[model samples]
Target: EDLWVEIQANTFKNWVNEHLRESGMQVTDFHDDFCDGTYLCALVEGLQKRPLKPSWNKRPANQHHYLENATTALNAIEADGVKLVNIGNVDIVNGNVKLIL
Candidate 1:
């Protein structure tokens, strides 16, 4: 489905380019595909270069969530001064996530 949407966007872009030629304007091809929906085509906001405010920027719950997580992390350090100090490989076993420490 994501691929389909991107294909649609490309098709729409081509159609617009052809129309531009009719107006005596030369265009050297263009691609307009954004499956992330961060962009919109002619009728959509993306094609017009209109930016969407990130969802996280609007949701109060998400803001609270990060705040809570930060506080928890601080508390962990305060209690034990222990923390994961490295980015290491993660493995899954028996449907459980195990991290290499």
Candidate 2:
């Protein structure tokens, strides 16, 4: 069960990375947060609900901007495909410093 959970988490993380790359958004550092299988599940489900958008900012001042833009894109993803799933209490703090899931 543990290995299966890990596999699922890794797959979800890879999907997130791929989506962020395709959208020209930098993947936010979730730090140790990735160790929590439930958190990864939540992140994946949240992202699926709203896919990341491509960056439109021509002159982002910093990496923070990229993350912000990516977040905006994620929130803007259309709600047509997979049905949205709800995971509890996932928070990104300090403007990408840490993710508490």
Candidate 3:
């Protein structure tokens, strides 16, 4: 199961990097790369091809700021007609690998 999860996570990372190439952003590790929510926001923006409402903080300083950024990303994602069940900003900010993938 661990190996399968790793492979799935790597696939997602590759997919994110592909979409974010134009933006010059990359997802190195699904678990650690999204801890601050910067890359996650970028990925969502790339996917939506639009800016997020209530813009996210480019440079998050604390946990609260990270959560805010994640919230913006998740909300924008949902706004784009993608339903995320049982996942929230806290999960992203906390770097929950399972939920993130």
Off by over 4 Å in 3: none
Indicate the worst ten consecutive residues by lDDT in candidate 3: 24-33
Residues 1-101, candidate 2: write the lDDT tens digits: 65765565566557766655534543444544332222333344455654234423434455555445434433443333533334212233132222221
**Where is model 2 poorest over a 10-residue stretch in terms of lDDT?**
92-101
**What TM-score does prediction 2 earn?**
0.33
Order candidates by TM-score, high to low. 3, 2, 1
lDDT of 3 by residue, 1-101 (tens): 89988998989888889998988888888777798888988888887888788888888899998989998998888877889999998888788898998
- Indicate whether candidate 2 or candidate 3 has the larger lDDT: 3
Pairs that collide, model 2: 53-73
lDDT: the better of candidates 1 and 2: 2
lDDT, each prediction: 0.30, 0.41, 0.87
Task: Estimate, for each residue in 1-101, the C-alpha lDDT of model 1 and write its tens digit.
Answer: 65765576457557655544433433232221111111112112222233222221112244344333333333333344555443211111111111211
